[model samples]
Target: MKLDILAIGAHPDDVELSCAGTLIKETTKGKRVGVVDLTQGELGTRGNAETRTEEARQAAEIMGLAMRQNLKFRDGFFQNDEAHQLEIIKLIRKYQPEIVFCNAIHDRHIDHSKGSQLVGDACFLSGLRKIETIDDSKSQEVWRPKHVYHYIQWYDITPDVVVDISGYINQKVEAVKAYKTQFFDPTNKEPKTPISSQNFLDSVTYRARDLGRIIGVDHAEGFTVERYAAVDSIFDLI
Candidate 1:
């Protein structure tokens, strides 16, 4: 099905952690939203790929996503080459979304930046008529998203756009907590990682709260844009 927005990430929980509130806010308005996980996060310290897959599914349901696809690329070693771009281009053409949310432009994790550039490049390439992609044994038409937004992660990059997700922060938090293995859990004996801390989990809520404070909202999510966002009038922003 055609989507209104498609959020792509380097790992299973990335989208939920970064922009679940924004996505859920859109979905509540009857917009079709989806996710494309570039990897299964096989290399994670706490859980294996199988567990992450299940967690992704639960999170997708929590976020009310219309679709969730995993490209299954290597967890930490995926490249930003033509081959990878073509695969992402196929999804871009197939979904034909108007807005595409991708990994942070720059982040502490190497894969985040890599996936961000790869997906951004693919979005542009997918619009080229001669790129030639096929889905389900039929030729696919080229499609390009009008907007590409990079969700903030690990870093506090200022946002070009912030959406009021006042009523959706709890939903976002639930979706994020769906990844039981990755986030804070006192009972999880697998192993402790940088993200498996109480502070990290609390930060998610406090961060959104702080962003909302800047705009006079209860909660919000921020995204960086590839270009200057435009509106017909200044009041249109309000």
Candidate 2:
């Protein structure tokens, strides 16, 4: 099915932590939104790959997503090579989403930056008519999203645009909390990690609040653009 927006993350919960608010807001408008996880977060200290997969499923349900898929790329070691690009390109052709939200340009995790560049490259290469790809049994057509944006996570990168998700903040928080093993869980006696902390968990919601405060909204999610975001009329921006 054609998607209005497709959000991709290096790890299962990356999209929830960074851009769930924006995604929840979109789905409420009856937009066809989907997610593609490049990795299952197999290397995380707290949860196993199986657990991460289940969490992703629950999170997708909370966000009202149209579909979710995992490419099963190597968790901390995936590369920005032709093989990986072709995989992402196939999905781009299959769904033909108008916009894509990808990992930040720079982040604490090496995979985040790698994923950001990889996805950006895939989006560009997907537009080239000569780059052949196949889906199911039939050859797929060349397709490229019109806009690609990078969602801010871990590191506080300045945003080119901030989406006001005031009314959707509660649902956003719920979607993020679905990843019980990945985030702040007092009962999860497995081990402590950067994200398992209560403060880190709070950051997801607080970060949205902080961004929202700057723009006079109750909640917001920020994204950096590949190029200038355009509006036919200046009033449309408001």
Candidate 3:
């Protein structure tokens, strides 16, 4: 099905940690939004691939997403080549979303940045009619989203735009908590990772609050753009 927005991340919880609040807010306004996880996060120290897939589903449900799909790329070794790009291009053409949210352009994890460039390149290639793709034995039409925004993750990158998500912050927290194995959990006996710390959990909330403070809001999500952001009217900027 066609979606208004498609949020893509390198791992399952990336979308939740970064842009789920914005997704929730948009979906609440009757927009059709979906998620595409590039990998199952199998490399994570805490959760296995099977567990992460289930957690991703629960998180998507918490955000009231229309759909969520996984590319099942290698957790840490996925490359940004023609083979991978074609796969992502197929989905972009299939969904034909107007806007696409992807991983941060640069982050602590190499995969995040790699996936970001991969999706960004796919977005452009998907628009080229010569780049043929097929689905279910039929030729697919070329489609490219008008805007591709990278969400902040891991490191602090100044955002070109901040989306006020004050009303949906609680929902974002809930959606993030759905990944019980990945984030802070007193009961989890697995080895602790950077994300498993309580501080990381708090950072997610406070980071939003901090971003919100910059624009005079209770909570907000930040994003970086590839090019100059355009609005139909100045009133749209806030």
True-structure RMSD, every candidate: 0.7, 0.7, 0.7
lDDT of 2 by residue, 166-237 (tens): 999889889888999888887888979988898988887888899999999898999999999889998998
Tell me the whole-model lDDT of each prediction, alpha carbons only. 0.95, 0.94, 0.95
Span of 10 residues, lowest total lDDT, candidate 1: 185-194
Tens-digit lDDT string for candidate 3 (1-238): 9999999999999999999999999999999999999999998999899999999999988899999999999999999999999999999999999999999999999999999999999999999999999998989999999999999999999999899999899999999999999999998999998899999999989999999999999999999999888889999876
TM-score of 2: 0.98
Distance from true location, Cα of 65 in model 2, Å: 0.5
Stretches of candidate 1 off by over 4 Å are none
Query: If the candidates were sorted by their lDDT against the true structure, best first, what order would they fall in?
Result: 3, 1, 2
Give candidate 3's error at residue 78 in angstroms: 0.5
What would the per-residue lDDT of candidate 1 be over residues 109-198, giving only the tens digit for each residue? 999999999999999999999889999999999999999999999999999999899999999999999999999999889878889999
Give the Cα error of residue 101 in candidate 2, in Å: 0.3
